[model samples]
Target: MSTATTQGGPELPQERRLVTEIPGPRSRELFARKQSAVPPGIGTTLPVFVTHAGGGVVVDADGNSLIDFGSGIAVTSVGNAAPRVVERVRRQVADFTHTCFMVTPYESYVAVCEKLNALTPGDHDKRTFLVNSGAEAVENAVKVARHATGRQAVVVFEHGYHGRTLLTMTLTAKNMPYKHGFGPFAPEVYRAPLAYPFRWPTGPDACAEEAAAQAIDMIDKQIGAENVAAVLIEPIAGEGGFVVPARGFLPRILEFCRANGIVFIADEVQTGFARTGDLFACEDEGIVPDIICTAKGIAGGLPLAGVTGRADLLDSVHVGGLGGTYGGNPLACEAALGVLETIEQDKLVERARHIGEIMLPRLEALKERYPIVGDVRGRGAMVAIELVKPGTTEPVPAGPIAARCHAEGLLVLTAGTYGNVLRFLPPLVMPDHLLEEGLSILERAISQG
Candidate 1:
């Protein structure tokens, strides 16, 4: 990778420089090949193929640099090709690639589990196991919960996105792109209402109490609390939009879970590892869940997910039942350790909060200036704005606005069940000026839209 000087920093000169039109000739050719070779089911937000990425910029194959605000859907929190992650991964690659933890356990794997046990929320004696993706972590967490509690039902919230796997897709609420014709999904999964402040039938003030009461009442009456194995939720829902539940909702729901024997599982897949200004989003409310599923930001850009929770609950499962073929690959474990080191050394938690201080006010201003911006909400770097038509809450699709951003060399992502939420998860390492420029691009895009 090349390094250059910038006005603000002397490191990797991360800037938005458009050498050609957004999808210039090189990227268009690559995209054409991808369309022919890849399945139609797989979709891409930006057609530009990345050649090198670091800090806040993604350099496309055509030499155009786009300012990144999505952070690879929150995977590269420390930034792509982060120094620590790259060094560790390089060494691990030279030593060995995969031994499959199930066959031959390694020190790095144990170290990663140890870090997870100590880092995740809750001071209880915790145990951790690794997996390949967020969906696998959630599925395994559910498995352990069911085995420990001896229950068959799992409760999840509406507008919550777990993953794309069969069971996770069943747990997911959105129907179109995620679940359409994908079912019949796994059974015994029930959906509960989320305390979504903006869309709650009652106002934001009443959403917490009423939504929690209704959800608990539904579980009690419809699913039977005693029969429920787990209550899985995303502290701040990711793909469902960055919907931070009303203040008291999580605690209320957690109380109901404790009252029953159901395990409270926080799917921190998209909100963990300093993305939400805390090491984990659950810490914001001081809620310590029985099982916490984490992925995305765990290992920089490596494929690794972890399920960390109460030791007793995890130990309840049969010994051979929890092992996977490539669950804790050595390379990923090394990458995870490097990621942890980066989080600690770089003080990314504080950086995430600083990013929020920079972004939230700007987003709130957008809400004030644009009638199409219905609401702006989120914590730390994980922020979003829900789009709606003027004078009404009717959804205004986010696609046109996002397309405009892409054309202007800004990378952003859209979410929400109605496809109207523009979520921003900028890398914690992104410079302040780039953040401001990206937001300006977004403002212009919204105006044009």
Candidate 2:
């Protein structure tokens, strides 16, 4: 057995066994009930309701096991119901669910923060505060930056996704689903061009220097760097198509921010916690930020987020200024601690690199084989393929191909501003055979297209 599978320690058989159709009879029935009871705003990719999931496969309501490629949007990097996470969560839950960390804090919460402070990239003295979601972490990071600098304007990059809250929505570049019809967005948030090498207007070679220069120029002229509180961006763009900014792009932005005294905040929500081979994606370029926002893979499958930053920047805010009612709840904190342990002990960072080794070449091969595949890019488990019209740069919709994968028992996710990128975020704990099989399924779907 693979080390990852053994460490994830799933009791369920680690095999992709489709006993029935993808969205088998029971799943179809539940989805019907869901349609009537649940709000339409909540969208689902694969309609199969999961009964149990661990290791490489998710068993649906009808006992059909499917290969898990999405990892619940990169939240289950340690694997669903991972042994350590499950054990810790159970003990914490049995002891106490929520005393409201604000009302009565616990040692687990403090422990989780300590882990965050030590683990996140940076040798400087740091402090960490927990939150319920990535949006809250991001919102609070902005608050800290603004409070520390006494500045109003914030700069963000194009194709970067912060979150769905009002301020974060304004920070995000996508329109449909996230920002469409959601007007009256918060002000003082300005967008700048990202060094998206694949789609850069001036082409890939000049993307790094040009995009950085353009962003700095825009901030200086429009927003005025002196007036900017923070420059927030994802280390690897997540929902905006897993776009890794050009090699020199991030370092340049960091230099600009350092010169201007503007806080550089890395929203490492999707790309954090071994998803990008590095523990945090920012570490890949050695571009440490003043404030780092983390969520997704922080607590295994539990909902928890963290803002770990320089002691000076975070401490500048008032004592009462940076907390929430359920922020750092005991159960979630314990889960987070377990997640950290699993990552370190299981060596998931190396596993993520190995997954990249498995995925990138196969995806690159697909790009060479198919005209629709315009680009194949990403660092580790967080890889993607951008689809375009044959012989042109025009984007081709990824919906049909993704649906085909769903029908064939491969759970995949699509992203991109133009809805043309197929992103694959497989769990680090996945077995090798399943990874290869998932790729085969995707190849068939694309070949059909």
Candidate 3:
């Protein structure tokens, strides 16, 4: 790997290198060990074994360095091995790791919640609850919404992905991988069609209105609005191909929820904390959801998730109803504080916008060059290019193309319900030149295909 330098940071390598094959010898040995030790249900996106990471690069066990565009599925927005996060985590680990927030509350946990209440997109006085993962946060949100509103039904979009827990799995739309045989899911979860302009009718504006109308109509016809507790949606669908809804769609839905006394829940697990340019994607639509679910990038790379909402709504549940034993582990909380501070001090939000500016045009150029490039859409740095048949809009599973890219050392991820979308979630801290280099690799891989 050749060394390159950003403006002020330490110099790092620019090009990716393949020492052995894709997995290399060490990775194969580890894979065999993982297969025996790890659960069969858990899966890996890439076969490469990582040894260390920093900035935008992930170093593998075989000494090959690759640019990280996936960011651990949009978790490491502040970048892998961020200095601030590392320092804070090191200090926190020295002080304490866990005390069970429920048994003995700590200042760090409360401090993190304070940041969420202040940072999440809402002007009203808000409260927050820290959780272990995205699924736990979603489940707690449901519990709070149900307890506060005395309603049971939750409306989720058709292509939405909540989590793997029983209740969240029911809230999720996909079946094969997420819900496959996890049947008899939680009750009171309803699926509604989202405003997917690429597939459905209605222009951007009209699509938003039409989806809201359909949802309202369904609520009236099937489940009365009074019986519904919350309407959960992703500002930009994550696993569902980074689908950005039509203009005014979210606002219209928010209005419908307000009119019907239904809680509005924005699932920002994959789109929050500067991953999509803005600190929160809902800010783009000028819509403030009653409840906001966040994870992934909340703690840089730590496992932490939270649900922030209006103070009254969050406090509606009794004291004991909202906590877990390891809900807000001290180390994760400190890391979250560091992540938030870095986002502000380092100006990573604007950096994410810069990344978008650099990436969007390249993707557009690719779309013009290739007939299989059906659509390119995203906000800020969260972008995706969907693959389709030459003439028809039918999704084309270019998993092979992705595999080839992986073999060549560029790690990319495929999304969409049909597994045809190439989603990009590079760390916001990546240097512009490094990002361009990764994009060049992507273009070459696509061109060869």
| lDDT tens digits by residue: candidate 1, 1-449 | 33433222235666889999989999999999999999988999999999878889988889898999999999999988777887888889999999888887789999999999999988899999999999999999999999999999999999999998999999999999999988788999999999999998768999999999999999999999999999999999999989999999999999999989889999999999999999999999999999999999999888999999999999999879897888888999998999899899999999999999999999999999988999999999999999998877799999999999999999999999899999999999898889999999999999886
Q: Judged by lDDT against the true structure, how good is candidate 1?
A: 0.92
User: Which residue runs does candidate 1 get wrong by more than 4 Å?
Assistant: 1-11
Candidate 1 — which pairs collide? none
- Which scores better on TM-score, 2 or 3? 2
Segments in model 3 whose C-alpha atoms lie over 4 Å from true places: 1-14, 202-205
The predicted structure with the larger TM-score, 1 or 3, is: 1
Error of 3 at 263 (Å): 0.5
- TM-score each candidate: 0.97, 0.98, 0.96
Q: Using lDDT as the measure, what is the rank order of every candidate, best first?
A: 1, 2, 3
**Clash number for model 2?**
0
State each model's CA lDDT, in order. Answer: 0.92, 0.92, 0.86
Clashing pairs in 2: none
Q: Mind sharing the TM-score for model 1?
A: 0.97
lDDT of each residue in 138-212, candidate 2, tens digit only = 999999999999999999988988889998999999999899999999999999999999988889999999999
Q: What is the lDDT of residue 405 in candidate 3?
A: 71
Question: Which is better, 2 or 3, measured by lDDT?
Answer: 2
